[model samples]
Target: LQQVQPQGEDVISGNVSLPKVNVRGVVSNLLRQRETKQGPERVGQTDSDVINLVSMLFDFILDDDNLPVPVKALLGRLQIPYLKLAIQDYSFFSRGGHPARKLLNELARAGIGLNEDADHLKKDMVFKKIQSTAQRILTEYEKEAVLFDELLHDFSQFMQTEVRRSQMIEQRTKAAEEGKAKAQLAEKTALETVRQRLDGKTVPEVVVRLLTDGWMGVLKLVFLKYGPESNNWLGAVKTIDHLLLSVAPTEDDAARKKLFNIVPILLKNLRQGLNSVSFNPF
Candidate 1:
């Protein structure tokens, strides 16, 4: 019994390699030991079939490359316990929703994304929880089937909470990325508009700086808040056009009068736009 008892700590800690023990042989030996104690008639054909099936199931689990190494090792430690359960309750094979079977499935699912590196394993909460559950089973499990039910309930709750937290983080990250992209696009649109308006125009360096820097930011803000088709965006664009018209040379008296009218409104709009983006207009 001592020799066949699972050495889970060694496997989990990576202190030693997983011993190459024969699953069928181990099951047979344990069964023989039990038979000696409970009378020779206890071992039978049904028990032999159970042993073979349990061994095959374990073989498949151990050989699966998809499962993380730590997960496989921990599950391997449960061979004796699972074999006992299968032999005790033949319904374990027939029932799809069996507590023991569900527990194993949940454990495997949780381990799918787990990092197998030793340093990461130490910090992995899921792996720690699985290790705790396996340790509890190894130490406390006997003939009680309710143990699996309780463990499954607790593990499922933990997993659900973790999944929700992960979803919230993912959503926030995606929103931030989307916002950054929209802001970049808006800035590009604003710069293009400023360049098109200023092309071949002889304006003072201060006015050029205002349009290229502060006014461009205002346009981006307007586009972001009200969109390109909105009245607010159109108003901002008109302000830029008026500023350019006011600054251009005009000799006609009527045109000079129009320029005088445009100057005050242009200055007012420029003040408001600069103020909106917190641009200093000294």
Candidate 2:
């Protein structure tokens, strides 16, 4: 700190000097990030200080009584898993390809009236992602009461399983195209031959493999946590039902047929999960 005794004019205003510290590696990483328009090459699932800082700001905003009613209502339903992921997985938020990041950008655009900082804030990639998620929660599901975290939890698990399965199928097909058809068929036949004499770790691996598509994967998302023991099975079940039923039969033929084939499996899984609390019912 650089300081001097108060002069006559300063004495009247009670002026004082304070030390200033520059933020570079810790936070100004973002300022440089904006200037360069590129995020760091690698990212992981943890950034304690950034996560804590964002959390503190969220709490501060949420607790501010002076905020308008709509702002409060918007923040209330904005809880989602990826909000934290956006902080933890820096590339996902900053590299400009993620939908979650787009959601944040949307929020930046929404902040025009309440604070003057909003105008400048929209340019920061990280800030935009955080804000856009809050905005989407408010606008997208205004008619319903939903916790964004729970929604992400239910959806991400199912989507991850499906996406992973599709990736595996594509890999297998590519291998076969590269002249590995015999190997692929052999592997499948070997697994089939051992169907009755399954090993300990085999069931889970196979379950994951089989649950790669619409029929089984959808079942897991719907009733796995929607049992009677769950806190809000009704709401979770309702959300799943709405998502599934909204797709019209004429719109997508393949999806419609898949949805139809899924109903029976979904019912069986639902009965096993919610009723018996057993992972196996079929």
Candidate 2 is scored at a TM of 0.21
**Counting only residues 3 or more apart in sequence or on different chains, how many pairs clash (N, Cα, C under 3 Å) in candidate 2?**
5
The number of clashing residue pairs in each candidate reads: 0, 5
Each prediction's TM-score against the native? 0.85, 0.21
| Candidate 2: residue 116 lDDT (0-100) | 23
**Model 1: residues with Cα > 4 Å off, grouped in runs:** 1-37, 117-119
lDDT of every model, 2 decimals: 0.82, 0.42
| Cα deviation of 119, candidate 1, in Å | 4.2
Model 1 pairs in collision: none
Tell me the deviation in Å of residue 167 in model 1: 1.4
Extract clashing residue pairs from model 2: 103-132, 104-128, 104-129, 104-132, 107-132
Global local distance difference test of model 1: 0.82
